[model samples]
Target: MAAIVWQTPANPPEPEDYIFFKGKRYVRPYYFEFISHVKNRWAGKTIVDLFTEEFRGRPYEYYESAVKSGRIQVDDKIVSVSYIVRSTQKISHFVHRHEPPVLAGNVSILHSEPDVITVCKPASIPVHPCGQYRKNTIVGILQAEHGVAPLFPIHRLDRLVSGLLIFARNAGKAEQFRQQVTRPYCYYKSDDVI
Candidate 1:
């Protein structure tokens, strides 16, 4: 005879947001979670099928848009609406909670060319939205404060560190930087050992 292992659902994130700028500690809301009890429940089923048939209530269109916007994740990784599940897996839905921090000082835009834009990002401002950060990110700041939109970031810097960052205005401009720019830069801290 085989033994069965009991399992419990994941604890939902609290109403208050948790964040860690440098270390790996952050908490974000989980709108909902679904753990397949049966191994074959998701076999040969599309991502939308599981949401519509199993977790039905709202229209299928809702789930479709949610998946498209990266609100759905299969086994901790965001997946598309057309993704297929082969076996029992955990699905998590994340909801964006708009609780961004406010910074009084203005971010400096070093340069703004037709193809790219360079800005001096402040410390504690995230380059993009993730975990507990949303409207407080560099991209968000540019839109709300400087009125720059549809900017594609070429590279990223740590949220806890302030430095110059570059962003490409379009995909073609991004490719140009990737092909033409080839310079080696070193980042080292003198503590004790290399």
Candidate 2:
């Protein structure tokens, strides 16, 4: 197994992560490369069909246009949309991503330890990548701001909820924490209920 590396914030958040305007937070549009490998189940399927079936984020016409424009590639080379995929073949999709604006709240670190880190998650930002949010999330902000990577969230908070969140530094710690939290009588209390 590979050794896990723990990172902490060493610099400020990246300028490209967001733009603060009129008290609103908006993430700047950026390009992202979505890379994947063909699985055994996908073998013999057309590239366009595979994309259309597996990824519903874009329309079939968009995938066709991307394939033709070389925005989508197979094994580092552009291929036709009708090209048949083979097992273990590499596929790349380069897309321009735009995340929606979120609340101009900060994700503040509350505590840190060798195996765990705690933070005060702000509202309007998802804990991780979901739906249309990829970069405008707590994980993304922590990575861009603090340089922490490969984080394993022990629990999650809703996008509209603000509260303390815990993250494990490594997979083992995450699993251990999960086991503890999943035990019977391991309950949570909200401040509002107090």
Candidate 3:
């Protein structure tokens, strides 16, 4: 058997293993910034306008509360929703933190090789972090259980689907796998094609 170089930490942090967040909790803040490029493009635009443009799905009242709570800032200074923005300025926003739903299940490692690994992903586990899913994902499970790191998934299965999934251990292997899957294979020689 191959030697186990690393194992799950004896006392893994609560809710997850990775330390990508500050609080060591599953929930983390959402932060982003957009620098003004075109002059006067955002001259009359209010903070609410920019946030609404960025998050069209959210109701206007959501941003209203965010501005009131000082969660949104302009160049690090808390501003109201109606605060007008200027060109060449920086606008930043941080939303309230919330934890992603914890998926309860197991992931079976079907096969492993030097360059790739095959696993049977459980149902309801997302392939990657997005929206309310940060930890409690396939990648998180691999890190928390197995010692896999820097994993590159060659393909993805829906969050609700369970099936065999392949992951490349490195970038080179991932690129090679991508090329092989994307290009059509010709069994015959070039001369055989009419």
Candidate 4:
């Protein structure tokens, strides 16, 4: 009869595992700028815009405190929750403190990126913070999930509605989107593109 031998493990501890509903598992090595893609892809938008289009369900309120703690990022750096995202930059999420970010209580993630995130917000979800929805809106869910850059709801969808709604990654892009929205489509092309 022959004797058997045993082996020992090498690595130490591993990171904690948690399930994310909206996080993009596909880490594509892509770059974007708030300028170039903003005008075309997600130009001129706010959290409310999406409500009208995707969640005409109802109205909601937003406070600075709730927005202040919201998470955001540009190039791996967690920035102002509401800071606008510039053109052609890498983006993602971080830990969010923005009052847990609200949701329509019913929605799903379609596509997400540094510059823009398309959501299928349901009609029951409010676009912004308000009522029991201070932490039940789509933005809230997103903020809670990754804690990236503060998000701006460019357009809205009805609470009961459903479709593609885009969100801005930072404040610069939010304001730029607002400005571009007021002007003609050919007015700006963004000085920054990566």
**Per-model C-alpha lDDT, please?**
0.67, 0.84, 0.68, 0.45
Instruction: Give the per-residue Cα lDDT of candidate 2 at 121.
Output: 93
Over 4-115, each residue of candidate 4 has an lDDT whose tens digit, in order, gives 2211111111112112245321111112111112222332333233223433444333222322343223464544434554445543322222222222233566787777
Decreasing TM-score order of the candidates: 2, 3, 1, 4
**Total backbone collisions for each predicted model:** 0, 1, 0, 65
Mind giving the per-residue lDDT tens digits that candidate 3 earns over 72-181?
66777888778988877765555433446444556788999999999999777788765656456787678667877667999999988999999999999999999999
**Which digits, one per residue and each the tens of the lDDT, describe model 1 over residues 60-116?**
998998888766778877787888886767776654344545343456999999888
Instruction: Give me the runs in candidate 2 sitting further than 4 Å from their true place.
Output: 1-15, 185-194
Best-performing candidate as measured by lDDT: 2
TM-score of 3: 0.66
lDDT of 2 by residue, 129-167 (tens): 887787788988888878777689999999999999999
Residue 66, candidate 3: Cα error in Å is 1.0
Candidate 1, position 182, lDDT: 62
